[model samples]
Target: MSFDSFLSQIKSKASELKTDVLKFKNKDFLNAAMAGSALIAMADGSVSAEEKQKMLKFIEGNEALSVFSTSDVIKAFSDFIGQLEFDKDIGEAKAYQALGKMKNNVEAARLLIRMIIAIAAADGSFDVTEKKVAQKIAQELGLNPADFEL
Candidate 1:
């Protein structure tokens, strides 16, 4: 192929790759992230307003998650919280199922565990309950809790 044609082809391929990467930041990943965070937030009995605000701030500040809009993030987080408020067992099961989506990707799983830990400690108190929740999340992600010092 000619030089110009090759360059155009490369650009088109790059665009395709960019679109694929963007797909990873869709509602499925957002829902999983919010569910995991909500589980951790509720570990200590209830999710305080401060904890919610802190989680929202972290989500907004996170580069990987920033691809999504703030309203979408809030809605996902709220939906998970609502599920938990409605039924504990069902909520936890649903959250775990969401988190399971990241189990096959080591890097993503690790990042998720770290995010959960950060959320758990957001209120300045990472208690035993929170740690247990983090550990559970680690397990659900097919990772070792010890890796994150959980």
Candidate 2:
């Protein structure tokens, strides 16, 4: 192959890889958001509309987050929530498991910790339930819960 042709092929391959990376990153956030919602829902028996709004707003406003459609996010949360609503074990463990998945990615791990803290503080008051769940999550994420001070 000629030099220019080789360079063009390399560039095209790089672009393809970048697009794949972006897609993976987006899917990760979708899963992470599902986990976050699970955590919020389990902190109490029911997930309130106001609470859902707060979480969605936070995700949308995050500088690093992608612009996911409301329906997409709702679907992930709904599926998890639906499972948890009737199934006993799903809700309680979902967020914790998700947090574990992101542990190797330091940035994602830190963000997840911050999110749990934010969710714990969402209702204008942090209670024992939120504190306990958040603490467990912090531990699972290998973060210092005291640093987050939930």
Candidate 3:
């Protein structure tokens, strides 16, 4: 499917799973989601303007995370990016640690993976770096990369 249609389907599916999404709206979930987004976005060393914009739009529009204020979401994403900019190895370790929090929650982990993939593909090119990062995320989540066709 096209990116727009894929995104639309994700949103619709999220709405259908509102209860599950709501339960995952806690600080840990937000942190993991933001960290995952940052990791995928920075897989190639930098995030494109379009990728950033599309990610923000997806976060804002996603029904599951709509409970958060726009500023809060922005802050979460920025905080992760700031850490990465400061130190690559350390920052990635920290980010992956955050993502590791969702490892036990299969549902949340899957959703997080999908969201990160969407962000990586937002620029219309899911490159090798992004795919590798995503594969690592899948392993961290106790999932298989093949499930996402990575």
The digit string of per-residue lDDT tens for model 2 on 1-150 reads 999999998667545533533554666656765676567656777667786666667545443333466567667766666666776486557655766787677666666666556545645777888788777777777777788875
Candidate 3 lDDT tens digits, 15-40: 76555667788888889988998998
Top-lDDT candidate index: 3
TM-score, model 1 to reference = 0.77
Q: Ranking under lDDT, best-scoring first?
A: 3, 1, 2
lDDT score at residue 106, model 2, on the 0-100 scale: 62
Per-residue alpha-carbon lDDT of candidate 1 for residues 36-132, written as tens digits (9 for 90 to 100): 9889878866777886787778766654556678789888888888888889889999999999998997866776776677667756889898899
Give residue 88's error in model 1 in angstroms.
Answer: 0.5
What is the lDDT for 138 in model 1?
95
How large is the C-alpha RMSD of every model relative to the true structure? 9.7, 11.6, 3.3
1 against 3, candidate with superior lDDT: 3
Model 3 is weakest, by summed lDDT over 10 consecutive residues, at 14-23
- Model 3 quality (TM-score): 0.82
